[model samples]
Target: MPADPAVVDTDCCIVGGGPAGMMAGLLLARAGVRVVVLEKHGDFLRDFRGDTVHPSTMQAMADLGLLDDFLKLPHTEVRALSGQVGDEVVHLADFNGLKTAAPFIALMPQWDFLDFLADAARRYPTFDLRMNARAEGVIERDGRVAGVRAATPDGQMEVRARLVIAADGRRSLLRDAAGLPVEDLGAPIDVLWMRLSRRPADDPEAPLGRASAGRMFVTIPREGYYQCGYVAAKGGFEVIKAAGIEAFRRDVAQAAPMLADRVGELASFDDVHLLTVAVDRLTRWSKPGLLCIGDAAHAMSPVGGVGINLAVQDAVAAANILHDAFALDDAALDERALAVQRRRLPPTKAMQSLQVLIQNRLIGAALSGRPLKAPAVMKLFERFPRLRRIPARVLGLGFRLERVTSPDAFSG
Candidate 1:
């Protein structure tokens, strides 16, 4: 624990400004709790962040009455998911016929989404966002966590709060500093993310994937280009590099022949970046005055692009529990924190299990040059459109979907 030279005070202090932390701040601020959200980065412009906003998240915006305004922002809506299986094109998951107002997944840049949430949070008088503020460790008072020590853009500082939220990402600083045990379920593959130009002549218009004997390629349509992902085996980048960038480009062209002409545009490896995917959860998510949500509590794989949605759900549950707890100035913050874990852990475990299964069953085989076989149930889902609803329910709505139940639901 860093000895505190406290410089700030609030009812609640959140250590991250991603979906979960910002949403919690937004809701808590509306409920009249003074809260501060610390984001180490000054902006959310990083590329390769998950851009899929599933129907569940759109429904949350509707519940908040911000759906119209949110849709106004530039985005591409993927109504149904289709992909090319080995030797056969398949209809995988469909989002149409869903009960939600917006049934499709919204494909907006991740930064724009965060900016929208941050702008919404600013409407609340109790919310404060500190940019370029990185949390160093917890500040302990007696047996409970009382504050956070951080290295700010200016200098070292401490922020004291009644409750602290660790929403910082998969590799979380606060979670580590608090001595939380993480359950690493492991991932079999990593992703190479890059972009390519999209001309008007491109076919197969919706976001989809291509799988061959040993490789997988996914492309998400953007305004003028495609955000692409190439899956590689665990610790396999070295092999990809040894094969050379031109060889890699040929591999991409082979996986998705539609972009064969554009493969030459890949240019250099610098244009590509690696996302070492993992799916894991913490043994415990709360201790004393602290609570962990989102990636801090459970790191998710990018299988369904549902990680961001799940994190936002965690935020709603946390705000529903803690906003009023701060208003009462209660002493049993540890209990409240534990309650948040209880509400979120089951769903977290379930989602991670599903992700790990996909990683082991689907991705592992794809990387090892085995024929990609669609599961029998998935084939049933394709033939009988009614059965597709089952996956739509799981992929779109999530296992434990959360609605904002706070008295201050959309006010923020």
Candidate 2:
């Protein structure tokens, strides 16, 4: 017979150790609320994760007094964003124009950022992080979520909490188990991600986008390599593979001529990882005793690379909205959960709408193999250099950025 599941009781239990879960755990625990965070993976080293930490996120770090230390980590900063179309390099957004502590977007490995947040949360005795804990489903009692059932390395465990938070990614088992309805905004492209060695003579810009007739490529600079993305039509990986690695290499070289010499580094299809783009969000983000945040509540496209920042924003808003109920030992948290959804829904919808717009307009056209040229908007950036701040503000700060207002019990 199987052993009895080990039971852990806390004020709040969060599933998934991604940005949303970690930031929420850190903020709530700092407010003297007992919290438990479950991460399915033993470590935070995943390559498919987004790495852009925009100004809004850094502002929250600065509010928590961790900005200086966080910036010390190895990262590449992009002060401006630019794209090349048919031999014309047109500047898009300028992060340097934004007024924030960290004016540029910092590209650091997602694992490093997660580790840093975990370290900060560890300082508070109220925080409990369980690695290798995969949440199977929610623990429902009396028609409301009571906790979570998880499989850990040791054995099956049951975490009982006053409230359960599903911060899991887009394919959240918890959200599925809870039976929340999703609205699909639709995405027309899939991205093939791979790493190419960076040469000293390569473009110094941290991120550069390239477009040609029927092809699009984006390169994000890292320490010794570039994290590259080759965009193709949705559900098209099979076709790409059937064309063989040689043809694939030619396509990539055609998209970004600068990487022509290094195309051989791809070696085989195994070097490329496929990311099926999705743009979706839940209609209702909460039920009686549970709340969903981050990708669990909304899945974004790779357009502006704003997923991480948006998730972080959701975490902050959640912590601010629900910290009091958890700290004060109030068991009635249903209404507060709905309030979080209400407060975050606007920005979530706005960003997703913007992503869908770009996907349908810019990305769809390029993927169709049609002759592409710089859009008229490119001329506005050139004509008025200060206009770059518009995209910069929307991308860096988001439509509605949340501030870290949760009281810190350790502030004494």
Q: Candidate 2 has what TM-score?
A: 0.98
lDDT of 1 by residue, 1-412 (tens): 7454549999899999998888888888878888999999989998889998988888878877889999999999887887777877777778888888799899999899999999988988889999999999999988889989888867788899889999999999999988999888999889999998998474556988777789999998998899999999888888998889999999999988888999988889998899998888999998887899999999999898999999999988998887667645446666788889899888888888888988888777777898877767667876798777777778898998888877773443
Tens-place lDDT digits, model 2, residues 160-252: 999999999999999999999999989889999999889857455558888877898999888888899999999999999999999999999
Clash pairs (backbone) in predicted model 1: none
The candidate that achieves the highest lDDT relative to the unseen native structure: 2
Index of the highest-TM-score prediction: 2
Which residue window of length 10 is worst by lDDT in model 1?
324-333
C-alpha lDDT (0 to 100) for residue 143 of candidate 2: 91
Task: Determine the C-alpha RMSD for candidate 1 after optimal superposition of all C-alphas.
Answer: 2.2
